[model samples]
Target: MRLLLIEDSAELAKWLAKALQGSGYAVDMAHDGQDADHLLFTQTYDAVILDLELPSMDGLTVLRRLRARGSTVPVMVLTARGELSDRVAGLNLGADDYLAKPFELSELEARLHALIRRAHGVSAPLITLGPLSYESVGRTFTLGGATLALRPKEHAVLEVLLLRGGKAISKEKLFEKVFSVDATTGQDVVEIYIHRLRKQLHNSGVSIITLRGLGYLLEAT
Candidate 1:
C-alpha cells in the first residue's frame, strides 16, 4: 500500500516513515499541511497518516479540505494530545482512526492495515484466490505449495489484483497503490513492472491476463 504522512516533527516523521516503509508500504512524507494538501489533492493514496499539530496549515484544515472535496481516502490522526475531546474532534472531522503519541509502531502498522483494508472493502486480513494465498505481513505470495518473495511494490500491486480475484484494475489505480510519489512518469512504466510480474507469474504457471484497454488481472487457469 502507498501512504502519505503529514507530520511536522522531523525526528518522529523520519522514524515513522522508516518504520512504515519496513512494513511494506510506500510512504511519502510532508512536513507541513500545504505540501500534504498538494499531495492529497493531486496524487492518489490508499491511506494518510495525518498529525494534528502541523507547521503551516494544521492537520485539521487539511483533513477538512480533503473531506470537503469529496475525497473518501481513509485518514488516521496521529497526535500528541490524548484527551477525549481531541479524539472526538478528529473523528468528527472524518478521521477513520486515531493514535496517540508514544504508541507502539506495531499498533500503528496494524491500524494502517485495518484502514487500508476497510477502505478497499476487505473485512479480512487474509486475501486468497484460487491456489494462491497472500501473506500481507510477510509480503509473500504462495502458489502450489511454494512461496515467492515479492518486492514491496510488486507485492502491493499483486495484492490489489488478487483481492479482486482476476478483475481488471486500472493502471492509474495500480500506480496509486504501488508508488507513493510520481505515479505518471509514463503509463509505460506501469506496463514495465506489470510485464515483469506477468512473466514471473506465468513461469510459475499462474496466469496473469492484461485486458488491453482496461488494465491487468490475475486469472490462473
Candidate 2:
C-alpha cells in the first residue's frame, strides 16, 4: 500500500520510513505540516502516519482540514505526548489510531494494518478468495495451501490488486505503488508485470483482467 509519513524529526522520520519500506509499503515522506497537507490533498495514499509536532502547521490543524475536505483516508497519529487529553483530542479530530513515541515498530505496523483493513472494509488479517490466501502481517501469499513464489515487483502488484478487492486500479497508480523512486523503467513496465502475473496465476483460480481504459482488475474465476 502507499503511505504518506508526516514527521518533523529528521532522525525519527528516517528510521520510520526505512522500517515501513522494509515492510513492503510504498512510502512518501513530508517533513512539515504544509507539505503533508498539500500531499494529502493532492495525492492518493492508503493511509497516513502523522506526527503532532510539526513545522509551519500543527498536525491537528492538518487533520481538521483534511477531514473538513471530506477525505476519508485513514490516519494514525504519532506523538511523544501520552496524555489522555491529547489522545482524546486526536481521536476527536478524526485520527484512526494513536501511538505514543518509544513504541515498537511491530506494534505500529500492526496498528497500521488494522486501520487500513478497517478502512477497506476488511475485518480480518487473512484475505481469501478461492484457492488464494494472503496474510497481511506476514506479507505472504499462498495458493492451494502452498506458498506462492513471486519476485518483489510481482508481489507488490498482486498485493495492490488484492487490497482493492476486485476494483480496477489505474496503471499509473500501480506504477507509483509497485516501482521504487529509483526505478529506471517507464509506465510500460506495468503491462509487462501484468502479463507475467497472468501467466503465473493461470489455473490458480485467480485472473488479472485488463479493463482497457480503466486499467487492471484481479478476480477469482
Candidate 3:
C-alpha cells in the first residue's frame, strides 16, 4: 500500500520512510504541513501517518480540512503529544489511530496494518482465497501450505489484489497503490508485476483475471 507520511522532523521522517518501505509499503514523505496538505488534496493513499506538530499548518487543521472535504482516508496521528486532551482532540478531528513518540517501530507497523485492514473492512490478519493465503503481519503469501516466494514489486501487486479480491481494480489504481509518487517507472510496470503474479498463482485454484476495459480481479477457479 502507499502511505503519505506528514512529519516535520527530517531525521525521523527519513528513518520512518526507510523502515516503512522495507516492510512492503510505498511511502511518500512531506516534511511540513503545507506540502502534506497539498499532497493529500491531489493524491490518494491507503492511509496517512501524520504528526501534530507541523509548519505552516497544524496536523489537526489538515485533518479537519480533509474530513470537511469528505475524504474517508484513514489517518493515524504519530506525535510527541500524548496527553489525554490531545488524543481526544485528534480523535474528534477524525484521526483513526494515535501513537505517541518514543514508540517502537514494531508497534507502529502493527497499528498501521490494523488501520488499513479495518479501512478495507477486513477484520482478520489472515486474508485467504482458494489455495492462496496471505499473512498480513509478516507480509507473506502461501499456496497450498507452501511459501510463495515473490520479488518485492510482485508481492506488492499481489497484496493489492488479495486485499480487494473479487473486485475489479483498474491498472492505473493498482499502479498508484504499488508505486510511490516519486517513482520514475512507467504505469506499464504494473502489467509486468501482474504477469509475474499470474505465473506464480498458476494452477493454485486462484486466478487473476483481466476484464478487457474494466481492469483486473482475483478469483477462485
Write the residue-wise lDDT of candidate 3 on 1-221 in tens digits. Answer: 99999999999999999998888789999988889989999999999999999999999999999999999999999999989999999999999999999999999999998888888889888999999999888778999999999887788788898899588999999999989999999999998888888898888899999999989999999
Which of 1 and 3 is the better model by lDDT? 3
Task: Indicate the TM-score of model 2.
Answer: 0.91
Q: Of 1 and 3, which scores higher on TM-score?
A: 3
lDDT of 2 by residue, 21-122 (tens): 777777888999999899888888888999999999999999999999999999999999899999999999999999999899989998998888888888
Ranking by TM-score: 3, 2, 1
TM-score of each: 0.88, 0.91, 0.96
Give candidate 1's TM-score: 0.88
Model 1 per-residue lDDT tens digits across residues 17-125: 8878766677899999999999888988889999989888988899999999999999999999899998998899899999998899878887887787778777766
Q: Which candidate is the best by TM-score?
A: 3
- Model 3 residue 74 distance off true place after TM-score fit, in angstroms: 0.9
Ranking under lDDT, best-scoring first?
3, 2, 1
For each candidate, the alpha-carbon lDDT, in order, equals: 0.81, 0.88, 0.92
Clashes of each: 0, 0, 0
Rate residue 106 of model 2 by lDDT. Answer: 89
Question: What is candidate 1's local distance difference test score?
Answer: 0.81
- Which one wins by TM-score: 2 or 3? 3
